[model samples]
Target: MYDLIIIGAGASGLISAIVASSSGEKVLLIEKMSQAGRKLRITGKGRCNLTNTLPLKEFLKHCGSEPRFLYPAFNLFFSKELINFFEQLGLKTVEERGGRIFPQSGKAQDVFLALINEIEDSSCQVLKDTQVTSLMIENNRIVGVKAQSRTKGNKEYLAKKVILAAGGESYPLTGSQGDGIRLAKAAGHNIIPTLPSLVGLKLKDYNQERIHPSIVGFGVRNVKATISLESGKKIAEEFGELTFRENGVEGPIIITLSRQIARLLSQGERLFLNIDFKTALSEQELDEKLLSELNIRGKEDLRSVLRAFLPHELIYLAIYQTALDPRKKASFVTSQERKEILAFLKHCQFEIIGDFGYEQAIVTQGGVDLKEINPKTLESKLIKGLHFAGEVMDLDADTGGFNLQIAFSTGYLAAQNAEKED
Candidate 1:
C-alpha cells in the first residue's frame, strides 16, 4: 500500500509525484504510455512555453470555463512558485514575448527532464505501460485503483489518496485520450462535454485555390482578424500574424480565437471572420492611394501592378475574387474593379463552419466539472481521497503559457493537500 497513486505521468502527474514524494509520502505514478511527458516534450513546437509571467489578476483573465475555480490553486502555487520549483531542480528559465517563460536552453526536453529528474531522484515509484481502468471506491470513499499492464498483467493497488492527472483527449498519441473523464464518470462525477480548443477553424465554401501549395504556408503579419455574428455583433478580435493552412486559417491569433469559436460553432451560431489587411489605413486613405498607384502604373499589366499591393500568393485570390482580367493594362482598369480590390483588401471575410478537431487541437476545452471537485484541495467533493489535476479538470486558457501554469499550479495544490491526508 502506498500513500498516494497518481495516474498519468504527464505534466501534472510528474509534478504531483515530485511534490508528494518530497513530503516523504510513498507514491506510485502510473503511466499508460511507454514514456512519460510525451506531450510536454512537443509543446511550444518542442521549446515548451512553461508558464506566463503575468500578475495574478492579469493571468486569470486568459483562463476560461470557470477561471475562478483555479483561484485557490494559483493562490497556493502560481507561476512564481512553479518557476522556482524548476530552478531549484537546476533548470534555468527565461521570459520571452507576451511574458512566456521557456527553458534557457529553448528545449522542451529540458523542461520534461527537470520534472522527471526530480521524480526519479526521489522515492516516487513509477509504473509505465500500465493503464488504470477504474477508481476503487467504497461507500463514497476512495480506496485505490484497478489497472492492467502489458508486462505485469492485472493489478490492484490501494492508496490513501489518488490524483487523477490523466489528461484530456487532445493528442491521443501522448496517451491523453479521456481516461480521466472516464474514471471520473465511473466514480459518479459530472463531466463537461469536451471539444477541440486552440485549433484551426475551417471556412465555409473556401476557394480551393486558397490552399494551393503556393499559398498554404503564406503568412501575413500585422493584420486584424475579427469574429462577428450574422447580425454583425462582434464577438472577439485579435491582431497579429495569420497563417493559411491546407484546410483553414491558423497561427497564434487564430488558435486563441478558436477557444471561443469552437463552442460558438457547436451552438449553431453563424460566425464570420473579417480580416483587415490594411488596418493602419482608413477606407478613404486606401482608396486615394489605390487611385494614385493605378494612375502612375498605367502602362503595367494589372497582374504586375497588383504585385505592389499584395503578396504574390494572394494576387491570384484578389484577381479571382474581383473577377478582373489579369492582363488588362492598369490604365484601362475601371472604377468598379478598383472598388472591388479595395473591398477585398479592407475586409476579406470567411464564414467559419468548423474546426480542425481534437486531433490537431493544442488543448481540450472541457473535462470533469469543476463543481464536483474542491477548489482548495482539488479533491472530489463527493468522493473522499479522490483528487484531480491538469487538463483532466475543467480548466483551459489561451496560449502564452497560461495552460501549462494551470497544470503546474493544480498539480502542486493537489499533492500538497494529499500529503496532509490521513
Candidate 2:
C-alpha cells in the first residue's frame, strides 16, 4: 500500500507527488494518457504562463465561484514559493507584461519536463495509461482507487490517502473530460454544474451584416468594449484590441469578460457589446473633428472622406448601415448623415448570443463546490484522507497566470496535509 494515490498526472497531480515524495513517502501518480501534462504542454500557446506575479489580494480577485477558498493555500505556498520550486528544479523562468511568468526558453514542454523530472528524481511511481474508474471508499473514509489500464486490465490499489487532481471539463483531448466531477459526486460531494469560461462569444447571425469574409480577420486596437444587459444595465467593460471572428469576438479583453457574461448569456438574458472605436477622443471632440473634416474635404467623395477615420471594409458597412451613398460628395452630405456615422463609430454594437463552448473554452467555470472541502488542508470535510486541487475544485480564474498558480499551490498544500496525517 502506498501513502498517497494521486489521480491524473497533470499540473496538480505532479506537484502533489513531488511534494509528498520529497520526504520519501511512497507515492503513486496515475494518468490515463501515455504522456504526463498533455494540457500543460500546450498552455499559453506553448510558452506556458506559469504564474502571475500579482500581489496576493490582487491575484485572488481574478478567481471565480470563490476566490477566498484559495486564501489558505496561497498563504502557505504563494507565487514566490512556486517559482522557487521550479527554479530549484532547474527550470529558469522570466516575467513578461502584466507580471506573467514563463520559462526563459519559452517552451511549455520544458516546464512540463522539469516537473516530470522532479517527480522521477523523487522516486515517485508513475502509472501512465491507467484511467482511474472510481475512488475506493469505506465508511466515508478514503481507501484507495480502482483503475483500468490499457495494457494491464482491471486493478484495485489501496492507499492511506487519495488526492484527486483530475482537472475540469475543458480540453477533452487533453484528458480533462469532467471525470473529476463524477468521482466527486459519487463520493458525496456537491458539484456546481460546469460552464464554459474564457472563451469567444458567437453573435447572432440574423442580419449577417456584422461579419463577412473580408471582415472575419479584422482587428481594431485601443478600443473600449462595454457589455450591457437587454434591460440596459451595465455589466462589465474592457479596453484593448478586439478581434472580430466570422462567429463573434475574441482577444485578451473579450476572453476576460467571457467569464462574467457566460451565465447571463446562457440564461437567455439578451446581452450586447458596445465598442468605442475612438476611445482617445470624447464624442463631442470626435464629432467636431468629423464636421471640420467634412467642411474642409467636402469636395471629396463621402467614401474618400471616411478614409480619414476608418478602414475600407468598415466604411463599406458604414455606407450600407447609414444608407449613405459612397459616391455622394462630402459637401452634399446631410448633418443627419454625419450623426449616424458618428454614432456607428462611437457605439458599434453586437448581440452576444452564445459562446464557443468547452471545446474552445480556456477553462471550465465550475466543479466540486468549495464549501465541502477544508480550505487550509484541501481535505474533504465528508471523507477522511480525501483531497482536491486545481480546476477540479470549483476554482478558475481569468486568463493570466492565476489558474496555473492555483493548481500548483493547492497541490502542494494537499500533499503536505495528506502526508502530515501519517
Candidate 3:
C-alpha cells in the first residue's frame, strides 16, 4: 500500500511525486511511457519554457476559460515560487523575451534530468511503461488503481490517495493520448469537449494558388490578423509575427487565436482570416508611401518596386491580388491599381477551413471541467482522495510558459493536500 499513487509522470505528476515524497508520504509515480517527462523534454522546441515572470494579474489573462479557478493554486505557488523552487533544485533559470523563463543551461534535457534525478533520490517508487487502466473506487470513496505493465501484467495498487496528473490529449507521440480524460470521465467528472489549440489554421487553398509556389514558408513579421466567422461576426484580432504554411497560417498570434477558433469551428462556424501585411501604416498612409515609391523608382518594374514592400515570393500574391502586370513600369501603374494594392495589403483575407489538428497543436484546449475540482487542493469534489492536476483539468494557457506553470502549481497543491501525517 502506498500513501499516494500519481498517474502520468509528466510535469504535474512529477511535481506531485516530489512534493508528496518530500512531505514524507509513500509515493508511487506511474508512467505509461517508457521514459518519463517525454513531453517536458520536447517543450519549447527542446528549450523547456518553464514559467513567465509576469505579475499574477497580467499572467492570468493569458490563460484560457476560467482564470479565476487558478487563483487558489497560483496564490500558493506562482512564478516567483516556481523560480525559487527550481533554483533550490539546483537548476538555474533565465528570463527571456516576453518574460518567458527557461533553464540557464539552454537545454530541456537538463531540466528533465534535474527533475527525474530528484525523483530517483526520493523514497517514491517509480514505475515506467506501466499503464494505469482505471480507478478502484468503492462506494463513492477513493481506494486504489487497476493497472497493467508488460513485465508485471495486470495488478491492483491500493493507495490512501491518488493524483491524476496525466496531462491532456496533445502530442500523442509523447504519450499524452487523453488517458487522463477517460479516467476522469469514468470517475463521473464532466469533461469540456476537447479541441486542438495553439496550432495552425488551414486557410482556403485558393490563397495558395494565387501565390507563387516559393511562398509556402514565407514569413510576414509584425502584422495584424483579424479572425471572423462567415456570418461576419468578428471573433478576435491580434498583432504578431506569422509564417505562411503550405495550407494555412502558423505562429505566435495564429496559434493563440486557433484555440478559440477551434471551439467555434467545432460548433459549425465557418471562419475567415484577414491579415494586415502593413500594420504599421494605415491605408491612406500606405497609399502615400506607395505613390512615393513609384515616383522615385518610375522606371523599375512594378514587381521590382513591390520588393521594397514585400518578400520576393509574396510580391507575386500582391501582384495577383492587385491585378497589376509585373512587366509594367512603376510609372505606368494606374491609380486603380494603386487602390487595389492598398486594399490587398491592408486586408488580405482567406477562408479558414480548419486547423492542423491535435498532432500539430502545442496544447489541448479543454479537458475535465474545473468546477468539479477543489480550487485550493485540486481534489475532485466528486470523489474523495482523488485529485486532478495539469492539462487534465480543463486548464490551458497561451504560449510563454503559462501552461507549465499551471501544471506545477496544481501538482504542488494536490500533493500538499494529499499528504497525511506519518
Q: By TM-score, who's the top model here?
A: 1
User: How many clashes (backbone atoms < 3 Å, residues ≥3 apart in a chain or on different chains) does model 2 have?
Assistant: 0
Q: Against the hidden reference, what TM-scores do the models get?
A: 0.97, 0.95, 0.95
Q: Flag clash pairs in model 3.
A: none
TM-score, cand. 3 vs. native: 0.95
Off by over 4 Å in 1: 208-211
Per-residue lDDT of 1-422 in model 2, one digit per residue for the tens? 99999999999999999999998899999999988999999999999999999999899888886888888999999989989999999999999999999999999999999999888888799999999999999998999999999799999999999999999999889999999899999999999878888998887642335433566667888999999988878999999987777677788889999998887877789999888888999999999999998999979999888999988867765665566788999998898989988988898777889988888888998899999999999999999999998999888899899889989999999999987888
lDDT of each: 0.91, 0.89, 0.89
lDDT digits (tens) for residues 268-352 of candidate 1: 8999998888899999999999889899999998888788878888887677667788899999999998998899888888899
Candidate 2 at 112: error in angstroms?
0.5
RMSD of each: 1.3, 1.8, 1.8
lDDT of 1: 0.91
Error of 3 at 228 (Å): 2.3
Model 2, TM vs. native: 0.95
